[model samples]
Target: MTAPTDTPSATPSTPPDLDLAVLHHLRGDLEGAEAGYRAVLAASPDNATALNNLGFAAAQSGRFDEAVELYERSLAIEDGATARLNLGNVRAALGDLEGGIAELSRATELAPGDPTAYDNLGQLLMLQGRIAEAEAAWRHALAIEDGPRLRTALATAVAATGRLGEAAGLLHQALTLDPQFGAAWAQLGAVLLLRGDVASAGEALANAKRLDPDDPGPRRHLALALLSLGRTDEAVVEFGELVRLAPDDATSRVDLAVLHLSAGRAAAALTQLDRALEAGPDDDRARLHRAFALRELGRLAEADELLQAIADGDGEQADRARQALVDEAS
Candidate 1:
C-alpha cells in the first residue's frame, strides 16, 4: 500500500496526553489510542488536537461518518491543514466528492508549502474528471517534491491529455529516480505501446511483470505487445499467466481462447471458452469464439447452428457471424 499523504505527529505545542495517544495510534493499539484521547477530552472537551487524533482513529477503523463529525468539531475549534486533509479524505470515502474537494482545497490554502495537500487535491480533482486542474495540482506537488510516485502520477495526467511523448519522458524520469518502481515501468510500457513501439513496450512490460509477478495488468499488455511483434507463442504464455492471476476474468479467458484457436489448438481454445461462458454466460464474444473453436474441431453442424443463432441476433457480433456463415458456405 502507498504511504498516506499525511501522518499524524506530535507537534511542539502538543499536550502530553495527546502525544501519548499519538504514540498508541502509531503502535496499532487503536483501543488504547482512543482511551488516551478520550481521557484528554474528559478534561479538555474542546481540545482540537484530541478531537483530530480521535477522528484519525475513527477513520482508521472505517467509521467515516463518525470521523467526519469529529473532524468538523476539531476544525470548529481550530482550522489546521492536517484536520482539513483528513476531513477531505473521509468525505471522499463517504461519497461526497465536491465536499472532499472543498476541504482539500482549503487544506492547500492552509498549508501552501505542504505537497501532501496538493497531491491529494489533485487525486480528488482527477476523480471528478477535472484533468487540467488535477495536472496543475500535481505540478505544484512535483515542484515541492521531485519523487517517483509524483512523477508517475503527473505522467498519467499528461497521458490523459494526449501528450504521450511528454508522459513517456516523465515516466522515464520516474524510473531514473527509482529503478525498482513497478508502476512506473508498467505506465512507461503502456505509453510506449500507444506510441507503436511494440518491442520496447514488451521489454518494459516484461520488467514490470518480473517486478510484480502477480499483477495481471502488465501481463495483459505484454501479451498484446508480443502478439503485435508476431511472437504468438510468447503472447500465449503471457496470456496464460494473466489467466492464472485473474481466473474469474472472462475477457482474459476469451483472449486466451482466441490465441489458442490461432495456433490451431482448437481443443484447448474450447476448454478456455467453455470456462469463459460459464463465468459469464451472456458473453457473446466468448460464444462466437466457441463457435469458431467448434468449426476447427470439425463439428461443422454444431458450429453452423451456433453461428446461425448469433447471426439472428443484433449488433457487430451478429454481423461477424453472418460473414462467417457466408464464408463457410462459399
Candidate 2:
C-alpha cells in the first residue's frame, strides 16, 4: 500500500500540536505524530486536518482499520478532498474495490483540478481490471497536469490493452519529459521485451539499472532479455544478483538452476534446485529439475524413483514426468 501523505489545509489556523504532528509524520516518526495528533484532537475534537493527518500516520504504521476510522471521522467533520483520497486508498488496500472507487470518484469531484486524485483513481481502476476507465482517468490527469509519472501510468494502461508500440512511444515521451525517470526507462525496457526486441530491451534496462541501482526490476528484466538473446553466461550472472537481492525468491533460484543445467553444471544445478525447494517445497518444476540433475550425476535409481513418484501424481507435472521416464527407458 502506498503511504498516505499529509495535507493539512482544512484547518484555518494550525494548532502547535497539529503542526508538530505533521512534522513528525513527514519525518517518519509515526508514534510521535500519532501522539501530537491525539493531543490536537483532545483540544479540538472537530479538527478535520488533524484527523486526516493522524489517519495518514496510522496508515503508514499499517493500522489500516484505525486509519479508515480516522479518515471517515475527518470526512464526517469536513468534506475534504485529501481525506476522501486517503480513505479511497486505504479502502483499496483493504480489498474494498467498489468502496475505494466510490471514495476516489468523490475525491475527483471535490477537487476537479487535482491531477493526483485522477492518477490515484486510475491506479485503483487498473487494479480492478477496468483498463478503459483507467486509461481515461490517466488521460484526464495528463490533460490537467503533464508529468513523467502520469505519462508513464497512462502508458501502462495503454499497454494493458495490447498497444505495445503506443505504450513504448508514450514511455519515450515520459523519458523526454524527465530523462532521470528510472521507472520510465524500466517500463520502456519491459515493453521492448514484449515486442521481442531483446537488444533494445537490454539497452533500455541497462540505462534503468544505471539510473536506479537499488531497483531489482530492471536487473530481472535484463536477465530475461539476455537469456532470450542466448547470452546464458551473462544471464546467469544477472540471475545470481537477483538471488542475492531477494534470497527468498524461489523462482529466481529455479531459473538459475535451469541455466546451470543447460551449461552442464549438474552440481551447481543441484545446489540451486535444493535452495529453491527449501524456499518453495511445493514447486514441482524444481523437483523435476532436481531429478534431472541427479540423472546427470549418474544417480539413475534416485532419478527414476523421483520420476515415477511425480508421474503417479494427478498434476500438470505428471505428463512431463512420464515423458522423462519414457526417455530414460529408451
How accurate locally, in lDDT, is each candidate? 0.91, 0.89
Q: After superposition, how far is residue 282 of candidate 1 from its true place, in Å?
A: 1.9
Going through the candidates in order, what is the number of backbone clashes in each? 0, 0
Pairs that collide, model 2:
none
> For model 2, what is the C-alpha lDDT against the true structure?
0.89
Write down the worst ten-residue block by lDDT for model 1: 1-10
Q: Give, for candidate 2, the lowest lDDT window spanning 10 residues.
A: 1-10
lDDT of 1 by residue, 1-330 (tens): 133456655678878988888899889999999999999899999999889989998999998899999999999999999999999999888889899999999999999999998898888888898999999999999999899999999998999999999999999999999999999999999999999999999999999999999999999999999999999999999889898989998999999999899889999999999999999887889989999999999999999999999899984699999999999989
Identify the runs in model 1 with alpha carbons over 4 angstroms from their true place: 1-3, 298-302
lDDT of 2 by residue, 186-284 (tens): 999999999999899999998998998768889899999998998999999989988888888888899999999999999999999999999888788
- TM-scores, all models, native as reference: 0.92, 0.94
Error of 1 at 312 (Å): 2.6
- Top-lDDT candidate index: 1
TM-score of model 1 (CA atoms): 0.92
